[model samples]
Target: MSTIASLSRSWSSRVPAKRRDPRCAEPIDVREKRYGYFPKMFVHRGHRYEVYAVERCWTVSRRGRRDRIERHCFRVRCLEGTFELYQDVRHNTWHLQRQVD
Candidate 1:
């Protein structure tokens, strides 16, 4: 098989590929932790990455009687790789964004 075809086949096989040497990281139960608003899918390079995401939202009260502001946060973890917090976006009273390393 050609390299491209092999790569495609390997990618389509969504099972977690073996790591040459695996290391342990702290286990995170995103569902229990953040209430399930984070994106469950991620893409890396030209392939899809299986990931678990945690999303949190809180409100900041405005002074006196003004309307409160809502803050949205996303925490994403790659099931096979590593990542970091990237950016946040606000739409009206909520936020939406992506995280990467």
Candidate 2:
């Protein structure tokens, strides 16, 4: 059987354009340290990455509705590299925004 890592690599390579484009944010699975606050780890494109440190974090409010949050953004560092991840509060879904470095 092919390993998950290998499968992820193959799948990612098949769609290089989408994977590389910052504009195309993809869905991801995230595990938060706190109940719903800080991200501890995340999986993107079938690859798991542990968050080493959170460089920055912020929340965006829905337009014309400051009381409602739109999404929560986090810039995090992992063993492989740095990434920007975000959680859509309204939908309660996570996405891999971009690879910072």
Candidate 3:
């Protein structure tokens, strides 16, 4: 092997692989603001629910299906007040309707 190649291999083997820091994985401020807090409600089946914001959502689709599904973590202001809640997976948009409360 060449001098350069041998040197590179020696150095690479000496270095330890970097690991993800648990603290860096999550920010303290965000944990303080949102962790352990979620909205509680019984939604009617056909009423409009006002959405203030969304925190996270995932789009999923099955094989051979033409349509995609979207799930949302939404925060909304309701008659009771504003709260964060997990919304069901609908089509492209979040469904608004009366939920049995």
Candidate 4:
């Protein structure tokens, strides 16, 4: 094997992999800011998480329909860890998208 390839493999092996669940669509209850609709806290599976900071926020539009928003996604940081949460615009319900820890 090439020297660079071996070094890259070694580096990757030493770093811990991030666990992610892309299909975690479980429903959640979220409390958001009154005006801008930013998530401040959420409850999932009987556990409550208070969002300390919003890392990222974006809207997912429907395929072939740019004007229509399907969901509002937020990557937030809480006391336990970072998590991806989203709100389904059509149903007006919240969901825990994934855990990034």
Candidate 5:
């Protein structure tokens, strides 16, 4: 590998391929802020995670078998650390997309 590639490989953490088991859609209490739906807290795995802040937000869509799946993605910080959450409109289920390393 090149020098830059080697440096990045050693420095950066890799995204995992295996997904974790999906917890049931947690009850996210949101409030309308200046921009949009701001999540305040959510209960998952019997633990209540209070959102310290929403670091970023974005949207994504992809073609599914029946229709397009649109989702709202959020990068949020809580007591633990940063985590990515997705609200899949097609299924009306919120998913914990991934946890930042």
Candidate 6:
């Protein structure tokens, strides 16, 4: 999230971008904490990351060719490291955006 985006007064006004990671859509198994909204485990690139903690989460949207695209992004900590994962709510897809550590 950009500084200005992070400072949004309300969740409805927040603007979100995919940060520095290259965009790729890959299928993964996710263990959900609640209604599959919160991630408890993440698997990608043949490596399974157990999400020990979810630091933060939010949703952002952008205009798409077909419809308004919404993404659910989670900043989480796992056995390996901290990472940002964003899920496309409209398409039911997930992207591994970047690693914080």
On TM-score, the candidate that comes out on top is 6
Order of the predicted models by lDDT, top scorer first: 2, 4, 6, 5, 1, 3
List, residue by residue over 1-101, the lDDT tens digit for candidate 4: 99999999998787545323345478998855535688887888889888989999999877645456589998999999998888889889888877778
Against the hidden true structure, what lDDT does model 6 obtain? 0.76
lDDT on C-alpha atoms for all candidate structures: 0.40, 0.82, 0.38, 0.81, 0.69, 0.76
What tens digits encode model 5's per-residue C-alpha lDDT throughout 1-101? 89999887765545244343434334443432334465667666666778888899998888879888798888999889887887777766666767774
Task: List clashing residue pairs in candidate 6.
Answer: none
lDDT of 6 by residue, 1-101 (tens): 78777676455444344352246445666755555478887778888888878899998888879889898888999888998888888878777877778
13-78, model 3: which lDDT tens digit per residue? Answer: 775442122111111111112234432333333333443433333433444365654444444455
What TM-score against the true fold does each predicted structure earn?
0.29, 0.68, 0.24, 0.69, 0.67, 0.69
On residues 69-96, what C-alpha lDDT tens digit does candidate 1 reach at each position?
3434344566654443222233322212
Pick the winner on TM-score between candidates 2 and 6.
6
- Regions of model 3 farther than 4 Å from truth: 1-44, 64-101
Those runs of model 4 whose alpha carbons end farther than 4 Å from true positions after fitting are 1-23, 32-36, 64-69
Off by over 4 Å in 1: 1-36, 53-71, 91-101
TM-score-better candidate, 2 vs 4: 4
What are the candidates' C-alpha RMSDs? 16.4, 12.2, 15.8, 5.1, 5.1, 7.5
Per-residue error (Å), model 6, residue 92: 0.5
In model 6, the runs with Cα more than 4 Å from the true position are 1-27, 31-35
